[model samples]
Target: MKLSPYFHDLRSAYQAELDDLTQDSEGKDVLRKRLAEKRKEIAFLVQMMELAPEMVAVVFHQGFRFARPMALEQLLGRGVDDLPGWSSLSADGAVVLEPWAASLAKAVLAEPGGERFLAVAAGLEFMQAHSRLAPVASHAEAEEDDGDEDAPEHDDDYDALSADDAADPHNARSREEASDNWLSDVGFDRKD
Candidate 1:
């Protein structure tokens, strides 16, 4: 559906916020805390949409995937009166989404302006469900390691450290990133 410039801008800001949260100095996903803060910030907007869907321009970023991209484009190109209802849209747009995201979408679509809410809630829920934390190798460390590739001597201590790093609790992908990657794998741009 065509959204107002305000809503479009809001969507862009929302995606940018998520992108910013995806990485830290440690290259860890710090999205959970940030997403909670964002949910609070937009709580009122979500409420407003629930009360008045027609008045709000709800936009979802990579919220749904179309089996036929051209069909979706054609639908968008037409007038609102010609547009299909939420059920048709949802059915047509539905694809294999991550479990958390699928649940969130189902919940949001059950409410007023659920279609619109899908855009906001699905993103936050996806992020909350998929973000990860891992020890990021620094550029200097990577360069040093690259230069040492010629050394045939293998350090058992280094191998042990690598094994330890794999088992480290902090070194893992967040649920949000996994969900985001799923969307990307399905042909939707994460930032979109």
Candidate 2:
């Protein structure tokens, strides 16, 4: 499904914000903080969109980045129907995103402007809630691990542990506590 230009612009802005937040990070848990801030910003933008969809430009980095100013107005006026097979209007100038991102964009655009923005915000929140950063191994560490033939293979154990964790209320509560602590560290109140 084709997305409206507004949705495309919002997506680009959302991703850019995330990228910017993660670009200069150092130490662990940085992504969690940035994700929290991004969620808050998105929530505010969505609220603004809901209050005044027409007034919200949804433009990031001016019109030069995503759709041209005229093109954006034209798309807004004409709606998605006028732009079949038209997709390449993002800050990255890419017509396609990761399948998951594309699906989220399509879902958001399925709604009207304000609702679409809200959907985007909800999507961000969902992403923030579920995302876990993988540890980046240094080259030396990678080489060391590769050479460790005696290391126990724990793939099955990991799978079983995750399954057990999913079924355990104590584990779930611990995860929630960790999440709450992270949120608080990032200056956000845990949503009840």
For each candidate in turn, the TM-score is: 0.37, 0.26
Best by TM-score: 1
After TM-score superposition, what is the CA distance of residue 136 in candidate 2 from its true location, in Å?
26
lDDT of 2 by residue, 1-192 (tens): 123444443333443344344445353445456544433354344445554332232221111222233343333333333433233334434222334344334443554563334333432322222222112223334466687888643211101124444479886565456555645755778778
Error of 1 at 31 (Å): 4.3
Most lDDT-accurate candidate: 1
Candidate 1, residues 50-123: lDDT per residue as tens digits? 43332122223334444553444344334323444455545655333444345444545666666644443332
The lDDT for every candidate, in the order shown, is 0.42, 0.38
